[model samples]
Target chain A: MKKVEAVLIDLSGTLHIENTATPNAVEALKRLRASRVKIKFVTNTTKESKTVLYQRLKKLGFDISQEEIFTSLSAANDLIKKDQLKPMLIVDDAALEDFSDVSKFDGKPDSVVVGLAPEKFNRPVLNEALRLLLSGGKLVAIHQGRYYKTSSGLSLGPGPFVKLLEYAAGVEAVTVGKPNVEFFKAALEDLGVADPTTAFMIGDDVRDDIDGAQRLGLKGCLVQTGKYRSGDETKISPPPDLVLGDFSNAVDQILSHIGQS
Target chain B: MLVRVLSISIGSTLLRGTCNHISSFTVKRLKSQASNMDGVKGLLIDISGVLKDGDVVIDGSVAAIKKLQSANFPFRLVTNETLKPRKTILSTLSMLGYNIDEKILFSPVPATVEILKRENLRPHLLVHPRMIPEFEGVDFNDPNCVVMADAYEHFTFENMNACFRKLMAMENPVFISLGIGKYYMDDDGMALDVGGFAKCLEYATGVSPRVVGKPSRDYFLAAVNDMNLKCDQVVMIGDDVLHDVGGAQAAGLKGALVRTGKFTKRDENHPTVKPDLIVNNLAHAVELLFGTSPS
Candidate 1:
């Protein structure tokens, strides 16, 4: 119940394996609780709802609430507000947590925000997008990465269609997620952390979590336990400062590095 | 070498499109298979300006059909008649004294619907409102994305927006029309075609529509295929380049534009597309296709 000076946690690879909680993650949280370090879990898994994500973590032994979970899909409401955009076309799951109340465009949208819609790629959708873009409709693609891996297999993320629209329109889109500074800025600001020099970012993806932190002048750690594949480390635009085996190792080092361990 | 192209006028046959002027094109001839001259020869003919006076058929046009039949050569009717079916059109033509059967006429509607069925879209119609009587048998309950037939202020944003109730969380369906041109009724000079309403939906949803009529290959081939001939053996005739000539080319058939329709003679030299042959009118086209026309 007590908010702490710092939150040291990982969402996917470290605190949980695949979609389940890692062993001792709850105990590690108890230790962080004793130290009064705020334990925040952030993830980019935009596919699942917050409740489902929290349930997965709970099933893995972490006693967490929905409020402590931060997934990219959760930011839809804030993002739509921040952009001051309405009449938006969503290339995402028909149902989303924060997107429950937004109005669907009558027929076409003022802008297209392609996040992650895996099911609705028929000619109507694609060609309608093409038609709008051809007729000068604006688009906002999340990130340009084509594919991302999970515990099971590689999946087609939102990046492929995002880039597809870009090619068709010959116009670029404003990004709104990981690897983009907006997400980092908002997350750090929400954490009430004033100094970036003392901050550390722990994530499994090298390009998004690590390079994204590095670009913002934060200590970036790549966790080898989750989402790390052979030759993927080589693809990071800027290498991370540290590459640890897991979240436990990264958080331990981070707490000690900031003189709070 | 006599090659008849649809829509392209006889004086200077050109593709009907944005460029409606008299221009020229460099003709590239394929290897002359004329040794036996026994191969197939495709002929393109128009129905409205060339054959009819609005529900009245020209007797000479019927004679033209017989003459082409007498030559042991087959001809294809490539028209943009969206209001009726092939059999009905043929029967009407027969009653009006044209010597043609159902094998010659092509209507873009049913063929476009079939081609679009493969896409499994819920279409919105924008045809004439009076035409709905003919569609009493049509199923509006299936894939009810968007449908507009002859809209007379009835296809307004308010009425169309009501569809947002069921179509929410789903992309808008395509608006298929026979053609995209300024339509007229009685004395009203100009009204936006279905394409205009389709554009409004596109602007509102960031989704444009898929046009299934005119230049659509599905419709072109369906028209040509009704004749039971190879696609290469059919020719397309129309008054618009985008609707007639370009549609034919996209369907792998040759196309021509008559100077009579929305486009003029200058459409012939469009850099990207050109018709195979140009003629003064359908009568001259008949003479060229039935006599010593070169393929």
Candidate 2:
């Protein structure tokens, strides 16, 4: 095992499950902070704005700062600014506050940016996005997650719709969130870590977080907590470097492994 | 008066360039049938929203059908209604003074039945009671698959959970969704459609359900293939923007959205699912396709 330089942690399944914190997750995070190891929290949540998400995390008692967070929505905002696009936004209404700085929706847009908006996934809206794509508009998908767990149950995410538009428009959307190496690289650069191999990605999702990070030279740690169906580790090839019970266990493994190294 | 554009020959290049101009300019009515010599081979029309809402037919819809018949142009009725059998639907239309042939009426239930039989699947049925007759001979006991449609009262928490487990259990049971609609207009008001529940199950199991209804390329192609015409040679006229017009356009056919049934003012000039033509109603749609309205 190699000594971990900086740790990139997942949010939903790793630190908390839905609105509540995972068992002893807060205390474990405090211990990790005490160890002097750099940490950054990342998420693929498209349901709410970054400010609102930060408020929820604060209420849950996690000692996280605004700069320590790297959300898919934030990454999408960067991409939109880089391209200087006037986009037709197809995202959750609650998440609109996050993009107040860059939104320029005026019927005819240069791009169609999509996220998970349950009500907006209706025929007219989706068709509008599709039509825009066919007529020389770029499609920017924040994250292509197949589905996510909600309070009621598992619900459809933005992945299927992204695929639908791709199929219909004969064009591919530029994915800007998790599993995209650029997104991970951006977080690593922010931490001033040049070598990605020393960073460990701890998450519950096998594909989006663990496998994706491992492919980019980060050590992958799979946590069996939120949305972890049985046999998830087997689903990914060149499996996770470490499999732990939860974030608390993941912290212990990282500490011991670094000490041994 | 309505005017159908010769959309196929114009190509998408001309359509995109002239879209704004066409929208701004009002189409002129043709006084004689000789002026209606467009190369459009067939018509694919929707029934529920364009013609009637429940048992009551919309005004001028009968005249619209009469106009189509008198013009001697070929047309087919395409619908995504999964609540009733085809015979019952045809009978209801006949009783409502609609002269429709059994062969020309296309719905999702029959195609779904064919898919089930071809795959040798025993599915847990989740559709309306009236729709059960369409799958009479198919297996349903101790199901290995889940079949979902607009089954208003049959959708239960336990049933959906059971189906989700079947998909996630590594056996890889198939999930079949007939129509992925959020809601529909029935006799009462807007009612929940099967799409929400189906999307939930899809999200849980991480399996993309096979949509057998409108907006699916297979559904639109099935109608076009039956008519023995190239997709570009046909025009689809319906009320729903996505399911009817968007689906048809995706399948390479010209789509026309009628301002009837569930159509709103916003739909006429929608940025994405823009129809090649926008008509007032079925009467207007018929006049556009042919040269004149019903006498």
Candidate 3:
């Protein structure tokens, strides 16, 4: 019920699903924009770069700028730069543009950064990653989502693969995306918002998005779209502050609470 | 049981009378004898190291079994060896001069088969090829369970990845590992055990496998229950302190660590587990229990 100052939105399954925008989502975002509320698009989508994602959003008729979008790819890039790590990237080719500035190690890498790279999920590549890990390199998982929703059906996420490497090498991976506390804190820091209670995070994932944000004092609004299955709300304790039908419904509730509707 | 208790109290009194000059070693031995003398009606013996190491039987091990048979003591050969089927293991022991009965032998294969049948679970087996016949009647269509053991050279990345995908596809994955041992002594020195590979799938799927071998309390209890004896009335003898002694103790059974096969002096003074008895070999354990020199 508190007045919303900043709102964090999830891109996939909330705003659009594979080049198609959610029903009434564009109009709902426009209404929130008119209220002069600061917004940042926080997504765990690692299959594509920020530019391609931004262009897709623009094409879908949503007025989202590239600067307003925060991705797990960007978080991984920040970590790579901060640590000065020469990593062997196991990510999709489309998502490579984001890590163009990062240097590659000639031999065994100092670290391994993994995402949803279907082509690289084979034995040889996984074995190579295992060798690198056994040789003292660390593993960095962009996100550990168990599964993601696609047009055909649900598909395997990078979580299982990440776990495979961790178990084989007897090492723990450093997760860089939701619902990691540092990922949420990094987005809040970028928005210049000191009070997390004033901001709201809207996403379809009960564990990663809703429970993740709620743990850090941010009010979570779980939308019943995207990767959400029935009874997902019961999976977490002190369930999400708001559970709505879709992203548009969640926005309507937020705007009405702040007297902006 | 009452006679054993009376003997221990009399022994304690005699040791205390001579306590003025008794060494620390004597006191330690006295304490171990006191604890082990109470109601040890049966035993769950390990096969690989205690009875025979590889194809060669340990000295006096066969005679020790004969002595236990003559006394009508109930015991079972409990093993975590998954490389061979239960029949093959029994035959090997038989050739090595130890006459072990097929009914009294317990291994992970038959135990896992019972679980699969009880749960009506179809399994995608990642076990050695030689152990296949043991699971003859179990369904393998549309696998809802993953059963892993020492696959040796078959522990390829492709096989592991295939199993990984199968588990991920299930609504609720059921993973069953034969044992949780880290490593074991083989012909080629020490080799990685099934636990390492099982850990990979467990880490990936976030599902802990049901271990059906040593260190699992259920496995030890199942063996103890077969002897028609309570946990406190049984003792487990093994070479590996952590899995055998520590596991048996955790399951409410007394554990005796024998100084044979894969055992080092370090196991005698293990940091975590204080074994109830530390004997030279299976013969020494039998001598302490039956008060007769089997050798």
Alpha carbon lDDT of each predicted model: 0.57, 0.78, 0.83
Give a tens-digit lDDT track for model 3, residues B238-281. 99999999999999999998777778868889999999988767
Tens digits of per-residue lDDT for model 2, B1-295: 1233555435333322222222222344223322332678898989987778779887678777887888777888988878778888898898888988888888887777767777788888777778888887898866777888876665544455556656665376788899777654445444456675676666556677889888998788778878889888888989888878998899889888766777776887788887777765666667656665324
DockQ of 3: 0.13
The C-alpha RMSD in Å for every predicted model, in order, reads: 12.4, 10.9, 8.1
**Candidate 3 DockQ category?**
incorrect
- Chain A TM-score values for every predicted structure, listed in order: 0.83, 0.96, 0.96
**Between the candidate structures 1 and 3, which one is better when assessed by DockQ?**
3
Q: All models, DockQ values?
A: 0.02, 0.06, 0.13
TM-score of each: 0.48, 0.61, 0.75
Error of 1 at A220 (Å): 1.1
Which candidate comes out best when scored by TM-score?
3
Candidate 1 lDDT over B15-73, as tens digits, reads: 22212232333111211212212333666676775566567654346666777788766
- Give lDDT tens digits, candidate 3, residues A45-68: 998999999999999999988999
Scanning candidate 2 chain B in windows of ten residues, the lowest lDDT window is B15-24
Report the error of model 1 at residue B143, Å: 37
Instruction: Give the alpha carbon lDDT tens digit for every residue of A1-261 in model 2.
Output: 556789999887788877899989999999899888889988888878878778888999999998788889999999999998998888888999889988855556888888878667654566566667767899999988766666665555677667656655668889998888888888899899889998999998888898889989999999998877778899899998889899999999888877888
Ranking by lDDT: 3, 2, 1
DockQ rank order: 3, 2, 1
